[model samples]
Target: MYCPPAFREEELPALHDLMRAVRLANVVTSGTSGLHASPLPLFLDETDGPYGALYGHLARANEQWKDTPTGEALAIFMGSDAYVTPSWYASKKEHGKVVPTWNYTVVQARGPIEFFEDEGRLRGVVERLTSLHEAGRPEIWSVSDAPEKFIKGQLRGIVGLRLAITSLEGKRKMSQNRSAADRAGVAAGLSASARPGERLAAAEIPQG
Candidate 1:
């Protein structure tokens, strides 16, 4: 994460919010074989540690777990990203120097990676994950809804992971480097775009 001072977000609450809101994250690790990446729905627990902890699970057959990592793992969470056209920049009119860029929020977490296959831990991770995603649904289905034997059997095919985040880098690139008129133009453009994600990002650009 190459972030300048103006674009850096040092607020833990904001980082945690981004993580939770973007439940789908990319977990990357480097092993003797090289870099390995997996997209997983990881949840952040901010109650402990200087940074926090991440929890998720992958299919037991995934070979990513077999490759031993030399150190901590990296997880990337992305939120509200949109493409910004130079046509929206006031600077473009002045000298045509502006270029296209992205406006978004991102968090990079590095932590000790621990993988487990214990039935209880796997069940706990999967249950909480299910509950978290299902919280807003009108009809809620729980782990107990299924027979114990069946649920236990299902857990055998998955592996759980816990990563204690040692370092967290957060960035919010919301046109902070652009002129006010340019930012306003971008906001107007994004606010009217067909994509809801662009509209959400439009609302985040600072008015200054």
Candidate 2:
């Protein structure tokens, strides 16, 4: 990601928080054939390493997993984003130099990729992922809730993936480059927006 210093998020805990808030990630890899990407619901294991590891599953039919990755794979997680109109900037009225831009948060994780078919490991991955997303639900679902034979058959159709993160980068472009007045204006404009994403982004803008 091309992140300016003002937008860069270098704190590990902050990066992990952004990653955990977003459920899906785009896992990209390169092989002899070319580049391939798959959207997967990855679960982060914070204690696995210094940067942490990611676990997810891919369909057995997905060819991306079959080809050997030439280098480290990338996983992208995108958080709340909103379009920022120049009209929201106070400087726009003063100098008419401001242009439209976007406010968003994102994390990119790169690591050596490994794919496995071990049924036990796959089941464990599935169970952990399920629990993560279903934590606050009225009726939480578990792998044991389904028939063992059915889950076993289902597991056969997919493969588990593990990426031991070697590098993690995060960017939070939330009007941090703007002046205090301009940022306040942006927050006010976004907070008044009907779009939920815009409203969420409004809360992320730094007040200072």
Residue pairs with backbone atoms closer than 3 Å in model 2 (clashes):
none
Per-residue accuracy of model 2 over 70-132 as CA lDDT, tens digit each? 469999999999999999899988999999999999999999999999999999999999999
- Residues 29-148, candidate 1, lDDT per residue (tens digit)? 887788889999988778758888999999888888888554789999988899999988878889998789998999999988989998888888998899999998999999999999
Instruction: List all candidate RMSDs to the true structure.
Output: 1.4, 1.0
The lDDT values for all models are: 0.90, 0.95
The parts of candidate 1 lying over 4 Å away from their true place are none
TM-scores of the models, in the given order?
0.95, 0.97
Q: Give the least accurate 10-residue stretch of model 1, judged by summed lDDT.
A: 62-71
Strongest candidate by lDDT:
2
